[model samples]
Target: MTSVSSPLQRLADALRKDTVGGFLLISAAVLALVLANSPAAGAYNAVREFVIGPSAPLHLDLSIGTWAADGLLAVFFFIVGAELKQEFVHGELRNPRRAVLPIVAAIGGMVVPALLFVAFNLAHPDKIGGWGIPMATDIAFALAVLAIVGRGLPPALRTFLLTLAIVDDLGAITVIAVFYTDDLSFLYLIGAVVLLAVFGYLQQGRGLAGALDRSALPNWVVYVPLAVVIWAFMHESGVHATIAGVAMGMLMRSSTRDGEHESPLHHAEHMLRPWAMGLALPIFALFSAGVSFSGFGTMLTDTVSLGIIVGLILGKLIGILGSAWLTTKLTAAELNPSLAWSDITGMSLLAGIGFTVSLLISELAYPAGTVLEHAKGGVLLASFTASVLASGILLRRSAHYRKKGVPAETAGRE
Candidate 1:
């Protein structure tokens, strides 16, 4: 890894990142949305909803939800958690000073959305439980947008957004654990902690370098089984199942400025994305996105779910825009130069694309009835609106930046 090879390797890695993995993910997401809106939607729903395996036969019981949540999502979180740890340890976010912009933005983003959601619920106190529905960042779509633009923005902008989204997820995970527990089950929680600690020790030792190499493709294997154990413990221990994603991601691996492409840990993260996207996310989305249009007209007027709608759309704009403005105003550091205040504002609006988080919160808060149905509507509307608006703004801004001779994407300020 000489300095000479490093730059070439990075460029190669970036190209690899975009071509294979990126293409697969984008294809999956696009296919999902299209299929959802297509006449074949019924078939899509049936496939995702279908439960497989025997009833305690060999005790290998699993549902559509179980495979997605317990199986594939575990891998997604494991990768995210690994990235989170790496950033803190060695990436751009290694220093508090470097991290402040995105950190403050993330905090404000989380806080304002939650407050707005709570306000919506409070106005119709019956729905107050649905407060956490508007608190997530859809990283894939965001990254895909950056990739699509091709030029005009600096690389730093994408990096900043990526870091911010990861932090935002960390916060959302915390909210789920604190607000959404079904039971104390202290004993189960204890089991989770013990499992967590065992993984921690393994990670600290780099999970016995050689054993990992022989068993897995690379020598740094620790994240996968550890994530599985954590999921089992976390689920049985009274925590929402997905918290396992958050927890495992946090403790998965040490960061490597060395760029451990062959490291088993990194290898696992790479391998897992397809499973998470092609399998887990699509499965989850298929099951969750179906909203019966029965009495559909009246549901729109219903305040509880409608409030969810207003809160997400309105709240996302305010929090993301206002906080970003405040950060620029109060600090010497500025927005990515290729991006205007307008661009950031538009991106903020897109931050309202709160589909996954909203769905998870809805699951925790209201498991039944028209209110949940409404909340579903609210998420769809808000996310759809936010994504379109953000995309529009980004395209417009990219044009402006290009006129001034900036790359459309890739974060080059000069």
Candidate 2:
């Protein structure tokens, strides 16, 4: 059967074409490491440590690293929010039955790694907070790797990974909001909610329903200021600021109207995605990935580092594979005939490439000191290790398919 074009297919194609963003992210990370270890280390440290933003009335003064984590990353989260909404509305997740495998795999991927991290840090109560670090799967990095090495694999594999990673992100965002946050300001949170409602009302075409197209509301004129207000309120309310993006994005209506096939959500995502993937994420990686190598050698013996590494490498592999296996056995579900066990294994390892969100969680979980440095190092190391392992497996599978005279285009038929 010939493959029909769908939202998931389009997403897979878009991801495969985003080679530039993937390369930029990796290059920026490498540049950070090189600068951190070279003679320019002092300048790098000063720039990252320098405080910026308002100090008095706004109380917004924050280090460069904090701005990267809390501010720029929100753009990335906005795209993620839109992707999640789209998936639930029009993609694979729209049907619960079709979505079960990835949902089960995502849960397994998150839970097992967290438990493994906790197991390693059980003796050290101080390090318990870092358990969330290993639970995230950086979809950008994973998709980049998949796009490069999995050309011969079925398109279903890419969709599976994308769905799983998006769910994993939802879990990560929930953890940040509930467990990582400290103190509470219900008033500010309520204010944020009100602003969000106003934003939704405008974007959803409520009062101005037939008066004007939703896109007619200039983003700079109405949306940007409202988003900033919500973000500020979220920050002040002791909730993670990135959550504002998620809440606002979900509040947007995803339905088509007024002879327009695309919703405002799709329009916003289309406008913002290039910047989020190409610049915002790379800048965040540049600021956050500059861990000093002074303690690199000692990370091997460090309990927190060991836990993060093992949790990502071993726990993700076991959890995802085992969950998928169990799901197939317990129900009438079966693996796609076009794919082999090796394909799943490679995808599982790729799921362990938790670079972006993992680093962000590391900063939140551990104080800025030796323990934190070790955790960051572990994240970098584990992601690299996973990339290498996954590359080998996927490449081998590609060659196997080639020898059988299977064309790469055939994969899209799924």
Candidate 3:
């Protein structure tokens, strides 16, 4: 009696929940760590290192680990791109007044972490390239932690965190595109750009009005192949293939036409977010988080590892909270009435849970060796520490709000 769509719809609904997605990611990472450090370590390494792609004209052959990082993460970034576009066009970023706080906070979050990393690595020029590792806040993980611990907290607090994380993601993406690329190929880069333009042109005609104006094909038939081609060209261009996902996501039409309930951007996001959260991210975590703990104690003492720990935990705390305070003082912007400095403190600490992009940057900054392993270990340790500390703070805040018996919508209102 069950319809085929029912199960998928239920699965999609579950994946959309931040808590569910977060649990899946954490479980995958933990499983990976266990396998890497246990008797199955050899099997884990073999699976990750296995390569199986065509090596023809594009040199597409890559290990499983590389595919997870470069390919699967692209799906995750595409969701980020769609969310960013929606924010810029129809959400918080559309209003400069509403945007300044999170925007400034995100910049402070990035700059302070980089500076902290550089300071720690000043004597080790060879390890300084790893500075980017601590500059990212894994949105899924952070949101999950917040959702679990922040029950009854003001909605404004969640908004503040979401906006800040999105801005933070944009900064991370920019860093990857500009700094991490190597051996650039202009010809292939141009081809990727051209494909992006064509993709954008097609999105303009995806609305109801546009569909009535001309015969149109389903998105899977056209957009999917086009996206794959763009991703391929980007991969060959020596830039991270994930950049293609971000570009295509931004190019999608965000404005809805007459009689439409949602824009093309939202529709696509709705359809794809489940895949990103349910499959792409968890698989990426499974492969990426398998760092061996053979010398974790010594690794923690390494300059590169120390920098990441300090940057993620202390740097993000100081950067996000300090910039937000300064923004309130230096400009007409003010913290939302429903939020207290305590809420911001917890959110700022929560920002320290930098996992996904941090791991990617670790791989990019260091070749396979002890340094790479240490860098990843630092990320895992810092993220765990931050999550625990932030949970303590948010849990207390949530209890306070709950005891007050005040609705979240009017928590701090006079």
Candidate 4:
């Protein structure tokens, strides 16, 4: 670890120690499903559709579900952005040599899954918008499973999976901003750019730091209003408002003085990670994961649904594993000696757990109705299947290492 004490790294360590965050997310999703299926279905529907704001100048009036997706989810994206910036500035991404393998694998993971989705949806042009649905890796769920099942694996394996996921998230965000946007609003876009620039400038300079209380400078005076303005303008720009979080995060300064104080980016990530995992993400899951069992049969049989499933499960497996193997063979790079080929294989399988972003993209791709319901069902089922398979492999591998009193590297060789 660097002397500066990156908050992103601290947050990751904290999350790794506390696996309950992933379970809470799963519980929220399961509870939503139960509510949607039982006699409470009507009440669940009402709650989801309940409106709570005036529809006017801001157009902020939105359903409970929309609020979860657009508003709460932006917080989650902000955390991701901050963590990404930290990684680029002070973490593994700063080194091209260290980053190349995971970056290549992540790109392969995305492209193959999308191609597989397109394969299934090519005939159905109406559903083609969803090709990006399966190209995601839910880091929380995947890492939780690995932490529990692959604890005996080398630590490097975790770093590999985390790096790949970061890249995977960046890809998903790009796809959302580029492929799923609506009517253009360049005026708002330009204004958003200027606001973001101002925010960046303020963050970079320390002239105003002495004017405010040390604690209030980053959170109150600099970030709050600028973030709001950026988000509002981003929303009006016909782009998903979540992108504002990513943009702001990337622009945040990660390098700090004295190797003791946290950078503004690190501070933001630390503060937001808990909120994102505990509140924002779980709320998003509760609102988005409720798919009526009415579409269960159709989702299993539908081409669009099958596309999502195959893309996530099989495409991710082949893409990540194949690309990783190819990278090692093509270059001097080798799998981390602390890890095993089996570890990579298991991690690749876990990458198929594309619950969060998959559901979000499904919503953007399909309108409210049966098609959307079926897509949600597919995402749930596919994520469950991936989790089960990955757990089985990882647990077996962990046991193998534990019994031998050695890392899986030697075990795999034997």
Candidate 5:
């Protein structure tokens, strides 16, 4: 007799599929758009702007939207950090020669977009602050699109896109920490660093292993409260609190100990990824993507919005594809054997789907008003356009590969 799967088990299995997470994200964004534009717009705005949290000591009180962007989204960044650590330690990023193409591509992807945004906003110098808006790629959205449309494509293409996006996230985080912070709190920042060091020590089993004589306590017992304290300190430091999550995730040991099945990093990634994708990200989209298009035509013409549109769609394509081609020519790096120029083109277009971090940066760049609305409008429009275009190209490529007898099951395996 076959054993029936529990509901939790079923949910876990579903979350493992890229398509499920992608669909949930798209659904949430669409629902938010509908609510924002309909008669319920006031209710939507009220819910998003509602504030809670303690105001003393840490001054954690913030609007619901702020909580979504700063608190919940940190979980997403933790996963990004874990994936980055995995890639650096054991995956594609381990080989410098193999890594050069994606690394250069990621750099080009960020630089060209910023340049294009700057060029678009040159007449309005004040609007140039929004250049970072187009530099991010929403890995969840892009991977979901690939899962839907890129069946039968080579696994290497997916790996290329993942590595490229991971690097892209790192660049975007650096921009946030460096350019966007309003005030610096050295004491709180120093405290955060010290705690991070302690967290790293525990992750390597150095701190706890000796204390318990090798029978360590549960991870939640030790790490969860410590993580919260670190996040609190980081938040008080005036740096974006999401940076704390990334730092802690990176601190986790990626290498497995003897007799262990997987490293602490991978284990944490496995447990937290579902929450990040299913709950944190969807809630973030609900609050952040509720842009109203009442003045849609004007927003399209605005310099900031126009810059974002051009940067995300045209700039990402040119930067990523051009840099990859140039790298193949100028260096010893070569394209993956399973991929072609057309596949790279499709991947470049898909990288234009900058949703999550784009919205977060929009908030950081502009205060509540028409300008922020227009920036978000640009992100949503560009992301939709990129998804459609990428689907067309990738679907065609998938069909071509299918006809060539490539197995669809191997599409995203690596």
Candidate 6:
């Protein structure tokens, strides 16, 4: 056999790499930015506006771009759901005591951000509803930042931060399902359950201990049937359809310790990661992140805009830092392993970077309007600043460890 060309090697290589998610996500964001700012911006709008006719047999309608939110995001959620289950069972959140710090931190991170948003908007009662805007941490974006600057931090410390972000994502998904659902239809849910149950039974027959055994949710099965069922039902139900992603993901099995083929979780994550990041997310970003900056002068003054800004910045800082300290104090839970107070503080700041999830909440809260744009701007500004500061601190900490010959794995969780 002939050796592959370098370019082909890169493409084939990305197909299975863990960092592939980051590559796809960043590329999409970049593409979105270019199209939005380029002379061909009208083309970008046109693509999103394109329609995908007849979702159900009844010929219910959906738009091409909107479909990403309703359809593809569900797959994304499924992978996330599977990951959450795995974490609860075997990963960083493996035990309750071990899980407490991140959970407390996540709770604080969410609550504090919302309160800050409320603080900004409470004076204007109409803006009160947007309090949830700051309550999420975009795991992909958060991890990307960490990966970029993560070398400065010890491996264990970096892993801890990533784990916290993942746990935080689970909370965001719950909030999306519980608080963000628009309309409910029990009949559709019944249809979804039947489909999922069929999926579960078929897979359960294989007798894997956990479902996250592969890159996609199910090792031996295709998710299309289950996804179609969930999409239809979730669309009909009050919940955001992306919740279907988490649901479908939870159905799969787990990977073996030696990283053998097709653990359900790995299989699921593999299948969804690129589509979520590359195709679906790019489609999503072009539509969702496409706020017209030219309207800033008039729009910035809107109470909604101001509220989103305040909520993300102040809220995230208080929620993340305060919660960690309080949890340690009350539970006497240990702080992360081998981490000094300074390092913990630095990582806490990184938790404030709220790009991906903030955008999602904005979409859920406002769909399309000045409010969404304002929230996007707020996320970009605050998360950027926080990430920069956090990077500097974390980088310095890494240098200290390097000089002292400290190993990264020593950075422990309580």
Give the TM-scores of the predictions, in the order they appear: 0.76, 0.83, 0.89, 0.82, 0.89, 0.79
| C-alpha lDDT (0 to 100) for residue 359 of candidate 5 | 83
Off by over 4 Å in 3: 1-4, 176-180, 206-213, 259-261
lDDT of 1 by residue, 279-381 (tens): 5555454454454444456767876566666666677677767776788788764665445567667667666777766777777888777777777767777
- What ranking emerges by TM-score with the best candidate at the front? 5, 3, 2, 4, 6, 1
Each prediction's RMSD to truth: 5.9, 5.9, 2.9, 5.3, 3.0, 4.7
lDDT of 6 at 287: 62
Clashing pairs in 2: none
lDDT of each: 0.64, 0.81, 0.86, 0.80, 0.84, 0.65
- Residue 70 lDDT in model 1? 50
- What is the alpha-carbon RMSD of candidate 2 to the true structure? 5.9
Scanning candidate 5 in windows of ten residues, the lowest lDDT window is: 405-414
TM-score comparison, 1 vs 2, better candidate = 2
Candidate 4's TM-score reads: 0.82
The best candidate in terms of TM-score: 5
Q: Best candidate per lDDT, number?
A: 3
Residue 205's lDDT within candidate 1 is 41
Q: How many times do residue backbones clash in model 2? A: 0
| Residue 29, model 2: Cα distance from true site in angstroms | 0.9
Give per-residue CA lDDT, model 6, range 1-414, as digits (tens).
667677655564564343565556556666776777788788887887788777666234777666766666565566667766676676655756646776677788788877777777877775576677777776656655566565645554555565677667767766776777655567777777787776666555345533433445653455565567667776676555665666666666564555556665776576556556556555555565453344456556777766665655566667777787877788866565666767766777787777666777777777576666766776666676777888787777777777677667675332
In candidate 6, position 313 carries an lDDT of 58
Which lDDT tens digits does candidate 5 get at residues 1-414?
545867777787677666777777778878888999999999999999999999988889999988988899889878877876787787766777667888899999999999999999998877889999999998767887897787778877777887798789878977977898777688999999999998887776665543532665666887899999899899888777888888887788898877779888888899888888788878877887787877677897798889999999999999999999999899998776667789889999999999878988898999988888899889989999999999999999988888777664343222
Each candidate's clash count: 14, 0, 0, 0, 0, 45
lDDT, model 1, position 143: 58
Pairs with steric clashes in candidate 3: none
